[model samples]
Target: MRATEHWPVVVIGGGQAGLAMSHELKERAVSHVIFEKNRIAHSWRTQRWDAFCLVTPNWQCRLPGHHYPGKEPHGFMPKDEIVSYIEDYAKKIDAPVREGVAVKKLSRNGSGYRVETQEGTVTADQVVLAVSAYHKPKIPALANDLSASIKQIHSSEYRNPGQLPEGAVMVVGSGQSGCQIAEDLHLAGRKVHLVVGSAPRCPRVYRGRDAVDWLDDLGQYDLPVDKHPLKDGVRGKANHYLTGRDGGRDIDLRRFALEGMILHGRLLGLEDGRLVFGDDLTKNLDAADAVYNGICTMIDKHIESQGIEAPGQAHYRPVWQPEIGAESFDSVQAGITSIVWATGFTSDWSWVDLPVFENNYPKHERGITPEPGLYVVGLPWLYTWGSGRFVGVGRDAAYIADHVADVSREKTAVPVASRKETRPWHGLDGYNLASAVA
Candidate 1:
């Protein structure tokens, strides 16, 4: 007979989402156990580059009741500082977490769930799948075609430029990771070529305030999917390209051009012996500028509506270079020694035994999986723009905890007929569907 330890609730991940969920559960006086596949906030520990800091200001590092109490509110928090914050939060809250317990299986067992891990099995009435968005690094398929002599490392494996071979580095995918790695390599005295996509960019500080503050005040972070007028645009591209370096500084690709770094649009594919790029360099650059200018315009309106006196904001544009084509380059002719693929990541739901995902992503209104007694947190747009970020995830976590409390208080057992035939109930992200749902 398999030994079964029972928990009222079992939280799957130990990252920011999981920790925040655990904090809420403890506050509600709910009984639960947290299973962390590795140490707390493992991604922050292992995934980020050595010099990486959060793009969001320190004040936006809000999770539940915890706020950045540090003196530097406008400053960006570094990787180690984030890890330390997670560690301290776990300690202070006494988050009931089991480190190094990788959940091997999560499947429906009767009306609840049976979670099997390397350590043992846990039977819980509900499961909060707190796995974050990024686990695996997404290197392009074209990477395999690169010369074997050219060392290639995904941004996740990169610690510093010294870890790479001596020569110019070609950084691919101009998303957050791509841009940062390119900046890092350039600053390290290596020749850098940045291959950008249609990723958006914004100035770090606008109108004497951090760009995030402007977005935050304009409700960009809190708007719902339908309420957002630019749903197509929001869903079209990845998050805006900006950096948190040097106490919130703007990271424009054009500036990189001025500093002698070559820039390209999107990487097409490998030709005979070179890399082909698309002709959308100017198009992509324009998209980035639109995002920056759009936000500034919104901020300007907000200031006017409230009759608030604000300093005049300076306008910035990318400097065109006659020396650079601002386009394609053959890898060999470009003297590219290595390639850093900073595209993004793909989600792995193989460990889950239920069919709750669409396109490898958990399909739910928000965080809800059709299954009852189930919940998810920390997914992009799971609840709001801030769902995946630490700033507002605590709110979603609390919502889940409330639903769990309600479910636990009920004396009636869910009839086998009405329950989702496939899985169980996950704390859905939208309106407290629990009242109508329960």
Candidate 2:
């Protein structure tokens, strides 16, 4: 039998969150290993569309010691540049990562933990699951009912308009990806039909400044999840629909409607060779506009209260309105040959056989779980609004590292001879600390 490898700490991801955690662990001289299912920034490299770019500005690319090095701090980084930034950070931090090692299961082993990977089993005193909640692409069960010739795909698999068959495309879900992909297809001169959801919308730029900058200045990003208006409920909210493509601009679905794109209400599954939809097209559009205007109103208040000299702008008006859209339509008759389900994603935590979950979400205060030495990170609103983004993940990682260091110190205080024998604590003063210490 192969001997089980051991580490003081093991991180189970290689994205920005995992990399940031590794950087913090190294800062405290904590010996650890990072097991990556694929290469660093794998999702950014493979999942994103070809024209994808950061919705936030480049300046917010703060990952521990690394910051955006490009000249255009205000501009957005494209897909390739974003991947390069992550790769460079990994190199700069000198993170100890084992690529292509997919962790199969994580279960308790005495007081420590056991990590069974595709390559081998490893034991660690502490494990940090830095994998974000977006583990699996979520598609409605009704998608299985679609005709096979219709050529359906999730947003993650969509590359460009050219990849789809030559026909009008129907994109379901008007979240960030949904709206953006719809625009991408529409810009390519393909007739687009969009199913609008309740997801809100935000202006890319407002009153002569980026909305993100205004929000950052308003200290919105620093607000903790608990202190947020929605509290934990904020995590379930869909991201505001907007785009940074083509120098960044507002994604006005209303404007798109006027420009010949057909808009519908929420997708209500298919029946009798026709797509059914709710009569909430106008409602959804109005809700999105209300949010767009609400943000402008908030920024306006901030400007007035602070007496900042900035440009003034008027509120938006609806460019078009749906006049009782058909509740159902024959997609084949409408020439809709492709369906893009830009429906978001969900995490799969079934492998984690622990009592640390509530309603599929890992129960934790910040990153520390109720189970000692088991933690989670890279989750939206884990601590602050920035907890999962580049602007905030480093701080979250630092906080978790401090706690991990405290746990390490407590273990080190116990005499080596008093502990059970399992795996040697390599490169740490010749301590033969058992991996199964209780």
Candidate 3:
């Protein structure tokens, strides 16, 4: 524990969420410092493939009071454009972000948080954890069984398939990352195999209008948190499907899969460079349907219990299944030359030493941890109505910042013990229910 003489209202991460926190703090005239592990939006700059674009429309890109100034407001922005937007946003708002300063550990100290970083230690009356989702790439455990001659990489490490050895490549996971990367490889003129794990069949358009337009019109984006808890958990849950916000944007993956892409079952295991999976698609679909219905029913019960009104007539009906159950494929396949696991990510809180999480998940409410003055943003589903993921993170950040500000203003003499400790509140039982439901 290196000690610093002075303290800052510290904000962790320099991604969109962190920037949003800093922006909000500036508006409220709060003095703060943001510690960024790398360059701003470096994940987007480095993680996504070359052809990657925003799944949601540009109109939904606004953060708090700032709207994206562009003619193509409804169009999806590309990776570079998004990076540029964040860069420009930082400049425009003058966020106090210090790049290359990675916080190594954080702990409770007196009335605030003491953050230990590579640069030095800084204390703050409050702390905001804005580290984005997808911090660590998830590679399959069975990958080691494959021959060393075969190449394997998580989507995080993949820049282009052109770097791969000349042969057919197998991409595992059917979520947004997997689909997009598989599409890119296929269009790049390589034989591609996509291993279908789980998928959500999204309507390219809703009732003759773009899906995003419908979402905006229905105020789906404006729906308060606590309405969609399942979505809140996607940032952490492994088997969750990716729901594309981009409507009718034909990517090469969909086209190629329809053409020559060989679809396989979930990647179960590998033997002698051969990947295996169950061969029964129907049975798999049945199991997925049961789980999906269970979640939906649980959510409906929660809504009814809380007296939360359904947003509209377009409110969840039996037909509004956001995900398609994985069709059963109960057999294994051979001849896997290479495997690309685009399965998604997990939290990299290894450097964050705190008692705010149960199994690495923050024990908090809409980003407020049990640890007083410590908060979080950019979780999978922090509150409700799909607020913590990509399209929802900005609003979530705003809400969290509001709560943090509230706590800060009352910073006068309220002993830290007065605040709730979330860890014990959501004990093992609560954690089990949350993990299962999420």
Which candidate number has the best lDDT?
2
Between prediction 2 and prediction 3, the one with superior TM-score is 2
Model 2 is weakest, by summed lDDT over 10 consecutive residues, at: 429-438
lDDT (0 to 1) per candidate = 0.78, 0.86, 0.64
Per-residue lDDT tens digits for candidate 3, residues 203-291, read 33333444556434334444433433444444444432323324335332333545777666676674454445656433433344444
Model 1 lDDT per residue over 4-77, tens place = 78889999998889989998998888899899989997889998899999999888888776788789988888
State, as a TM-score between 0 and 1, how close model 2 is to the true structure: 0.93
Q: Which candidate is the best by TM-score?
A: 2
Candidate 1 colliding pairs: 371-424, 371-425, 372-424, 372-425, 373-425, 374-425, 374-426
The TM-score values for the models, in the order shown, are 0.90, 0.93, 0.77
| Rank by TM-score (best first) | 2, 1, 3
